[model samples]
Target chain A: MNAIVSAPAARLVHVPLGERAYDILIGSGLIERAGHEIAARLKGRKAAIVTDENVAPLYLDALVASLEAAGIVSASLVLPAGEKTKSFEHLMTVCDAVLEARIERNDAVIALGGGVIGDLSGFAAGIVRRGLRFVQVPTSLLSQVDSSVGGKTGINTRHGKNLVGVFHQPDLVLADTDVLNTLSDREFRAGYAEVAKYGLIDKPDFFAWLEANWRQVFAGGVERAEAIATSCQAKSDVVVADERENGPRALLNLGHTFGHALEAATAYDSRRLVHGEGVAIGMVLAHEFSARLNLASPDDAKRVEAHLKTVGLPTRMDDIPGDLPPAEVLMDAIGQDKKVKGGKLTFILTHGIAQSFVADDVPSSEVLSFLKEKHPR
Target chain B: MNAIVSAPAARLVHVPLGERAYDILIGSGLIERAGHEIAARLKGRKAAIVTDENVAPLYLDALVASLEAAGIVSASLVLPAGEKTKSFEHLMTVCDAVLEARIERNDAVIALGGGVIGDLSGFAAGIVRRGLRFVQVPTSLLSQVDSSVGGKTGINTRHGKNLVGVFHQPDLVLADTDVLNTLSDREFRAGYAEVAKYGLIDKPDFFAWLEANWRQVFAGGVERAEAIATSCQAKSDVVVADERENGPRALLNLGHTFGHALEAATAYDSRRLVHGEGVAIGMVLAHEFSARLNLASPDDAKRVEAHLKTVGLPTRMDDIPGDLPPAEVLMDAIGQDKKVKGGKLTFILTHGIAQSFVADDVPSSEVLSFLKEKHPR
Candidate 1:
């Protein structure tokens, strides 16, 4: 608890996964110090930074300069910005670039943007030369709080999102909170959905804190850093407990199953629904579904929705700015999720706030009916 | 000793890699027993078999029948048989196929071909759903003794062979020696190169045994089983000692540095030189280079060449049946090898028979000069 509330000048959350353990450094201006920090921890002096076109103009130069100052040589590959970048084609390009740069097993492949770049680059680093040292410099709040902390690096395939990937943990993560200042209001709000998720999964007090200090967190300062650190810590705990997602780690996907379905339903058009927004709507639906199942109170569902809505997040299917498919279509999307085992629905259902449990035998008929009742006319 | 000579019914060499440890079951008719063996060891009832076109007609039906007999539902993906099949295109295909088959994490992806299919499919299995249980039903000698044992799964990039891959260990390996009956004389002889490699690396007695009983081993029975079992055990020991090739595992790459350069020189053209043929020549070159460096007697080099030549394998650049690349070009290929650390050449030089060691700082000038001396005009 003390660690979570520590002064936010810079928060270092260490993910202790034995030999693969790494530190997540969250602070302002950390990117300016990226070179020295990376050189101090990693043996290789060469790095290949994979960023997006959007982020490249913003921070790639500064990052390269920092690495140069630390005497670490680097090359940069800037891909198109967006969720579409997480594809096999992009993965191959990044891998080839890393190889062309002669980034060896000990050399670093740094992901210097949001989740897409982080995931795509992290995957290239994982497979190129059978695994290189990976570093995540997450630019968005969503990534800094969630994706960057866990070593779940991968790309999306036609069959589904994140259906292909590796569990390649990073050697270091530099989450420069200052960069969050550059995010759009929607992007920042979308990221907040994940921050709220950490609390909803297991930390009721943290959820309560975010609810009380939502404004301060949005304004960005000690509160923002505190929120990010706690979220990372929560994710790290889940990841370390079940690094392979064999059991309790499923709790972290509380809204993801439904969220992924919604994203699929919207054809993953960011104009209609981005990942975190899908998650926002999905989290509300999860709570509502739990209530319908008599597993939690409907008041808890309303509370979840209200917090997300207050943070400027989309909290319902109708909240999406496009016409979604029928409930049956959404159910088909859920059925396609890798989470289904032996043709049975497996979901993270809650008893109440911060009390999620993995329900491995959730009936599909029940979910379809729930979606039907909630579907926008 | 008893373990090595156990009455030839079937030999199970347990690779003791802690939690990731698995068994290599080597014997005749094991493919017919693959389903039972896999079912007994794995919890999954579903499997996706990735095989090359050449092997599918020969073994796919029998494998499917065996799995059906054991109550395992199976899907088969037939790919073209060759080193070229180890590519990102095929990797994506296998991954997509596995996902389309809805193979869960607990399910299995079985490789039922040679090194190319095993490498590609194992990579897919490792990544799909972040990893599925993998089973290797290696139908080729090279695969049975080497590629299938180590869990070094990957695809080739335009940069190099095995330049991209993952360390995805299989849950079980069924090395059906009876499959060897279907192999061509050339293919069998090519595989014999790796069988002899185990002996050359650290087993003087095994080398002497192979030299004495080479005929019986080639004839295929107890001696052939002994050769494969010994090779697998030797490889398992090295992998257990260093799974990631950070240390002693480099010894397994004995002859491989020169072999890869030769393969590159020939443009990986199978008609010009196959992998094991390159290895056959490279082992001779490695020993000859060791002799030139005064690391071992020239008599040892002569002996290595004599055995391989007697076994109908190419033992020199001149034996490659085509014009050879200039020494400088070959050196360029060697320089590009991932084994090169900070621009210094790394090779497996030997002290004497069965006493190979990783030479981390081998002088490139010496290698060039040695290649020039050995180059055929």
Candidate 2:
């Protein structure tokens, strides 16, 4: 992996949602400038920073110094790290601490970790005082490319992941690629799945570009920043067009249905499958399923699987550790997906690479049989 | 209270929020039509009905029958009735039950009771699937005129009331005046405070109309339907103008700031002071505070107090059942109000009745002194 140390100029991708539109700033060293960027845009000088234990030691001081340098006073709550932190108990704790800190409406809530922190903090911000000005300083590649851009903030309930949340747009998103350097190799590989997702969604030229530049992206070069910018722009366009996901926005969930069911089948054990890893495998499954349905060429499925495998991401059910549940169990979990409309399965299927569309009224029997063939348990 | 029980034609009040807009159906026996009304708007055939213990016996069967008649399959979750049920525990129960029922995004979560059920159920709906189709069959006058119309759904926290929730609008609201006949006189009087709140906010003509026709409104006459419809219209307009409470919508909290402080002081003991009754006293305090600030005439406060007294609503701190805390404590509670902006007190101080506005940067010292004068502890 190449290490290019000098910080590049930041690129701004604006998500226009009328009054709720905000900008996502992408580059290395953006976190050190977050205080200035946020203070310039928001009127209030006080803020509450919500982060996790893993992120606080490495990044919290720089964040605090930046805020202090900008004359912005802040209080913070450090939660336990990982997906389990996205719970009602932690949400309540954050809400109480925010209110206890006297963080008022005009003041901001800065989510300074990965997806869990962003979702939980954004949710607390969304509900406290009806809503608060929110700033996202996402520390992981997955959050920078996906969760941080969209206003979909929430926590996981036992029923499902991200089943509870609100569409709360951030006032600003600072996606500092420098933070990604601290992430483990496995974790970085996981986030690359979502970065690859945008290319597969509708950008064929971008997909071709990613296939060539995947190594530079992994190596934290200018290509890394370029990929993040491209992903945010794609997401911003979708979010602005359908902020509420009433129509076209559903296309963004290209691999989420199968991804979520796979996670559920594992009982959301991160040891077996992290979200983006699940998406890696799910995307491969979706492409393969499309091929099986004769909607796409088998070559496209092979291409998707090959790229995901090259990135060191899991791209098949067999890639997950341990004996898997029978296909019927996985099928049942898919039925519980939020995308299912009136008991009909809705899948984001591809005609070929970068040619995805929402396929509603998908035959359940076909899915069950496909899963049965794939699992063969 | 008179018991004139033949059903009247429904009155429809449209809350125009562009595409997010919905209609509030007010009159007698609208609950009996809830199934068809909701079925018409949403394509999904399954529903999860959320109600409280008190409402289940009184109206749940009728609601189920109505849905059955419309060929809508249903499941139900009955919660303990009252303000206490609006907690995290019940919210989790409701979320779990809805997911267990497999209520899809296109399907609905019907809130079939009063403000407590509406707030909790609507919150469950808001978070479940990120959001679900919602229908409000409000069984109490307070809910019909206030909570059901605004889409301000949430649960109470130890820090304060409505400290957590989402602005999830219902696809349909059925406000059946016939249900009001079953309420105890005190309960009905409490709801009357919210009805009076609409008039007090910015409708002097409606206030004058209410002052004259309040007796008929209490009697379940045609005036009752008229009163509910007018109040719904008043709230609908405000909600449309500011869906997120960022501006003029704060006027709706005319009595709520002081009222919430009082409720907190009493440990939210409904026996001592229910929400609407607390709002009654709080509204009087607001008017009096406006007079003290020379923002309005003292006679405006007096007139407001007298009208509330005539309707058997509590209008002063002394009307509360228990011995009270010192002014400093009450002042501290007010400091914690969600309306407090940047450690400054914000009040819905009025020019007089029907002339309310959001007053930001109100001095905390001034509030303390006024509370000291009013409480005289």
Candidate 3:
């Protein structure tokens, strides 16, 4: 992890999925070089850039100019920016726009925003023409560190989030740290939750390093790039080991099960809690639940809550504004989670910090009791 | 092929997709034994059957009884029958119903009808939980031989048919020939077109055999089972070789490009033409187109048209009930075909019967001119 941070040049984390293998380039100023990198990798000269309203004004011109410099003709689709945009309605819009753009199978669909844009665009790319060449230009830190690296892409349904989609890997992923400099402080902190999640998953040394040098990471430079690279490397390793999330990959969802339930409980209202914020609280809850189950030390849960609180992330259910539903309602949402295999809850519980493992058939009564303690009545 | 037809209690064609490999069981009485076969292969004791209105009344109860006999809990969603049913609306309905049934990842999603039901239900199964155990109990001849074996599951979009879907293979396929006895005469003849397609796609001897024994196949004894198994074998070979339709799999699209265009021309009206009828005409056009390009003898084209005509399948654009759009309009639709690469038309042209190859850069003017001859203004 330190070697990756100390590297002077741009870092390339290769996700090895045999024939579907591709590289995730992490460093400063990647958006400017995206054209050359993408052109070098793919033979197509046409591209469709799918961005959100918030992102297009900031980076669309630069990306289009970069592609133009590389002799790649391009079209753009600017969607509304928010979690709400990750729905079937927006999915159809993206699919239609792509087809209308005449983007062929060999051409590329460049997703140029956060997780919402990436998920929606990747899904459109996967289905349109039965599949198209896809490139991820994840502008947000949360997406760059996590969502961009994995092949999981989908839109949310009324039933649940990401319940309908496919595993369509991108041909290339450009994670430009330079772009994160433009992010608001709150947005960066939300994304940092995911960055910290990697360390909590299996890297004790890295978690300790973050505890010491998180200030430098927030200040933004080599440390920020290193954190992103480390996160990508960590995710890539797990994905390569289990592309379909059949086993070890579930470890990556340590915070996600509880996080998704929280999101669903709020009806995915981003103003109340964005994905990473929900994850921040969710991770604490996971640790607490682990401690409750005697799977881990209570001190580990306290440590997680303290660190997330220091970073200005929500670490408790109370952090969310307005009154949420009862604990039983939250449990109902969790029951509907995609992780519940064969009517039994499956969770990533920790033995200690950086020692996460999948625990299947987790008793729902225990989860309800835990939530009940967190939210009285 | 003869060896497979003769000494078989039930012919098994193994589709070798490595880890995703499974067997296609073909014969009479397989439906009665479906529950046992599925229970033996998969650990789950629950299934959600997605059939259509026409099929549910005919076989749903028997299927339910079979599952009960094996101690497998089963539920079903009966959709309206037809090509039009393969839509996002119906897809969402199936997804919701399956979720409402609480069908877990280990459970199976059984498609128990023709092409529409198979495509839609398979798609629902694929996306329900990022995929579920899919079983194809295809009832119609079209589905048994063609759609059921391949994992290409999806819904038709406003842009084109099958424009939105995933390549999700089934865990097991049960194609009972006895079910074909109940199909309408037109539907049976329509399905025979796909069965004959296998023979036309690289198996000259199979084509010869099909031409000789088509009447016997229609009579529904051993010959029907042989033809279905042979078609599945032919398709399985191509699918296993190129699971994603990247190379040799394109050969399977011999008539689909023209056929899809014709379907679009007729607005996908069953009163005018069904999919197989369109393919029958499209196959003749493809042969005639190849002959026009001096790639094959005109005699081959004539023989194909003659054979299709003898089978009571439409072999010409004139045979379609309604008037078609002008040649340029047809060419426009063909240009929008998903198979088009980089805006250039890609066709599967034949050298002779059963000797087809992917032909790229086919000129629009040539296709338009050919269509003009068929439908002069």
Candidate 4:
């Protein structure tokens, strides 16, 4: 009998959830042995492959064959590509498709796509039959760096992105580096924001590495591999300690609080802006906000702006275009923000580089004024 | 400082998710002191309460008052009542409402209501800023007994029920039995299904206890007050051990695998059959299925039916005006179930009154045959 084995790279981080905490095996060659790895997670004789259009044409068939090799019959559910698919209607359609294919709780769901696929499919895997076994086969660099490492899954609604979802951890996360080559230049760059975020949140070294090796990531070189893998390790470490985002895990939202607001303002499912672009701008805003409050030296704040600009990411509203939303709009966007409590604004500000604090007293007025500074001139 | 402490009779069941593991605190009057207990899980001064029309009108102000007493400023978001409100639109509305309300990341969200409210609020909590702090204040027995303890949150779809969702655990679960007194008779019975499920899934002694004191549950007597708390403990213990339902946790599906199908076929929001009523009937079907498969004795099946019926539950499909729905329809409903994988069936059937086996068999033909027997006029 082929028993499940943990990946060497995954061991760099440990899941903090005792029995629920398990290892995440990430590598270019990881997919080859994935069947053996996931066999133990199944209690039934079949499997379901949930993927999106982008990744399906590339690896769907191969994944199905892998499951078949493991004696688990497989069926596939291919969703339309892009963020638009992460909706209530789309989620139900996927459920219809799952039922149409006869997926069951005893069987496992192999999420064979990028972040959007992983989010929607992970969510599908999370709630189907209350919960089904799922293995993440992330085909995007961003997903590999952040999404695949954590078990957070959900769909987007008109109100906001990922507003309806769960923290359903996967049985296994198979982040194959090989798929990175398939991404377009724009897509590759988009995923890098998270790579950058790991540094902004906790891994200062990884951030420094990205600053030094930005070209390698863009050129797809040797250093790029280590950068993505290192980012994954950083994320995995945090997630292992705080899988539910109730404590230290909230630190991961370094760019997201503001980033999500901007994304929601523009319509999350639209290509008007990728999540990374928003975060790129959010990082700059965060530092500026940090400096405005005397939490960080203004020099460090400038460095943040310059570094994000060096990678060709948006640092202002004009970068994406349209209009500078009013504070009420921004407030409306941030108000429904996950950080708010009883109308209190919680801002994750930095006292300095490698220093962060969660505060509800940044004041909406400050948030609005700072965001206004980013107004296109 | 008056810390929110568990009831004297409250039993704690710790979920085993490494650092994410939290105890399910069960007892009467737990909600009155939830502010202190849940506030202990945080380091901030803000709290948001997401509730519904019916529940909020009755307890929202009281909850807010309690939070203020604890020096925690609280905000409340009240939506329309009923399961139909558990929609994609509502999830977005809530997220935006909260974000616009300026809730802080340091502030936590208190999910207060029955199952729908718990699910939608929990789901909203999941994606806001990538997950806000969550405290479940279950107001109904169903919410208290099942939805509160486990972090399962989501919305229903046009195709079926709970098709879109996630597993977002609460930092603390506040199941105050006093809330149950406000439930209508039907609502009370609906809540009982989840509580009774604990006994059916495991712990025969608990099942016997139910048989002895079920009168008190309907009578709403203190004699069975511990029953509410103990039932939650049983569930919380199992969920803690298997937070993601990989193994031992599946036993909790004692009647859900089939019950969800009935809910789907009948349209769950219709109020024609409350979830527990369907579950109560489902327990009967599951027992019969087990006996037919010779996994259980005929006597065991009879006792299971008798208990549910004595509690004013329907033991057959005739309770609702639905047809036998062809084998294909039954197949379709089961397929739409959150547990389907690769077109196969996974039924958690009882081998006896207190033993449930996650069965990978019970072929499509057998299931169709069973449906024919159970649904035939």
- In the order shown, the candidates' DockQ scores are 0.74, 0.73, 0.64, 0.29
Tens-place lDDT per residue, model 1, A1-377, is 01112233678899999999999999988988888789889888899999999999999999998898888999999999999999999999999999999987778999999999998898888899889999999999999988887788888877778989999999999999999999999999989999999999989999999999999999999999999999999999999999988899888898999999999888888999999998999899999999999999999999999999888899989888868899999898898888978788999999999999999999999999999999945
Candidate scoring better on lDDT of 2 and 4: 2
In candidate 4, what are the lDDT values of residues A84-129, reduced to their tens digit?
A: 8887677666666665555666667788888888888777776665
- Candidate 3 lDDT over B261-369, as tens digits, reads 9999888899999999999999999999999999999999999989889989999998998789998888888888888876778999999988899998898889889
| C-alpha TM-scores of all predictions | 0.97, 0.96, 0.96, 0.74
lDDT of 2 at A290: 95
lDDT comparison, 1 vs 4, better candidate: 1
Which candidate comes out best when scored by lDDT?
Answer: 1
- Model 2 clash count equals 0
* Quality class of the docking in candidate 1, CAPRI style: medium
Error of 4 at A317 (Å): 5.8
lDDT of each: 0.90, 0.90, 0.89, 0.75
Candidate 1 lDDT, tens digit per residue, B281-354?
99999999999999999999999999999999999898887787799999988887889776678899998789
Candidate 2 docking: what grade?
medium
Q: Could you tell me which residue pairs clash in candidate 1?
A: none
* Tens digit of per-residue lDDT, candidate 4, span B241-273: 787667788788778867888777776644577
What are the clashing pairs of model 2? none
* lDDT at A120, model 4: 84
